[model samples]
Target: MAQALGAQTIYEIKQALHRCPVQLSRLVIHKTQDYALELVDYKVLVRLNPLCKALYLLFLQHPEGIVLKEMSLYKTELWNIYLQVCRHNDLKSAEKSVAELCNPLSNSIHEKIARIKSSFETLTDKHIAEYYIIAGARGKAKKIALPPNLIVWQ
Candidate 1:
């Protein structure tokens, strides 16, 4: 009977769906007063240094955009986040680190940004990684191009 055939087809469709290896997992950033960023997908937790974490979070906060020339302006705010994640008892010793971050002439900030990009790539493909990177065209403002919907802010 057609009813029996339809029931068989339904069972087959359920089996097919169950056999397909597809599971969706979201990327989440766990927040803490310590100011560290823990990038978590289903299987990986990417860890970053305090300075790198601070810079990455700063960009994430600003979806609009930020340029290299403007890196100096974020120094105070960057330090505030960095200080919380830094493993130092005194802020004096960490002053040099913040100084370098604020220096427009320094490439250290660029290096940190690259590390953040690579960290994501290491966990996923370039396609997924690209979503999380600070992307911008030439002569344009760079941004942490991830969609606001994809990011779970904690």
Candidate 2:
């Protein structure tokens, strides 16, 4: 009866718009109104503190990866980024924090990156979180596994 009333309206099927395939590995870190890391496919949002977020942003800007042992070389650049995003005007304290972040001590940056990775891991599963983390071989430079094209600055 419905088909007779209107052929166009007769039982039809359509794909779900929401089900369109998303790049499961694609990730974005929002630095505009909020500080959060997102997994496009899974719609996962991981909010990060200003310090951690700044550190993560530094990695995003360096595609070739930065050597953990040579972090001191990036002190000025890292500090600049931190000052811009840390949401505070206290140069004295921000300077000190940046110093510690780029410190020569092997454990300093290692521990910080680990914390950021662990934070994301807690937001979703460890496997997905790994893609958002700074990872590399023992002696190789460390970088976020995400491709540059996939990153969204804002």
Candidate 3:
């Protein structure tokens, strides 16, 4: 779908056409392949760096969303995911990276999330990207807007 027209206009057109079910690419997370991200409908792979992939996987797992200030609570989970996704052999270095990412005082996590957003933006229109990206207002829980039914864990 070309986004040359405004999102509202697109919505109105879809409404007029009576498109009951909006078509959205399903996001597949291959857990056996270290949580690889893919758009099954589009036949596209969403590549993210190790840390970013870890963060994204975490967000996907918790559709309820994760508040930034409370990221420390999920540090262990993130670290475990990072370990699976990262190719480095240095476990200590990986642990340190997770520590930095989960630190409330550090902006590392935000940077990784920004990269994740950029990756999705390049792959799809903003309206559709919103479904796959992690987003939320300040002081609130950030989450992927994609519905659970559209997500597959293999």
Please give the RMSD to the true structure for each candidate, in Å. Answer: 8.4, 10.1, 4.3
Compose the digit string of candidate 2's lDDT tens values, residues 12-129: 3122322334344556666675546676666767666667777888888898999887888988888777776777878898878778888876466777888898887887666556
For model 3, what is the alpha-carbon lDDT of residue 36? 90
Q: Model 1, stretches more than 4 Å misplaced?
A: 1-25, 33-41
Instruction: Write model 3 residue lDDT over 34-69, tens digit each, in one string.
Output: 789999998899999999999999999899999999
lDDT of 1 by residue, 1-154 (tens): 4353343676776666555454334557676645434445556676777778778878877889888778888888888877766777777868788888779889887788888888878877666677778878866799976668767777
Q: Least lDDT summed over 10 consecutive residues: which range in candidate 3?
A: 1-10
Q: lDDT per model, in order?
A: 0.73, 0.73, 0.88
How many residue pairs of model 2 clash at the backbone? 0
Clashing pairs in 2: none
Instruction: Tell me the TM-score of each prediction against the true structure.
Output: 0.75, 0.75, 0.85
Pick by lDDT: which candidate is best? 3
Which prediction has more favorable TM-score, 2 or 3? 3
Cα lDDT of model 2 overall? 0.73
On TM-score, who's better, 1 or 3? 3
Candidate 1, residue 88: Cα displacement in angstroms equals 2.1
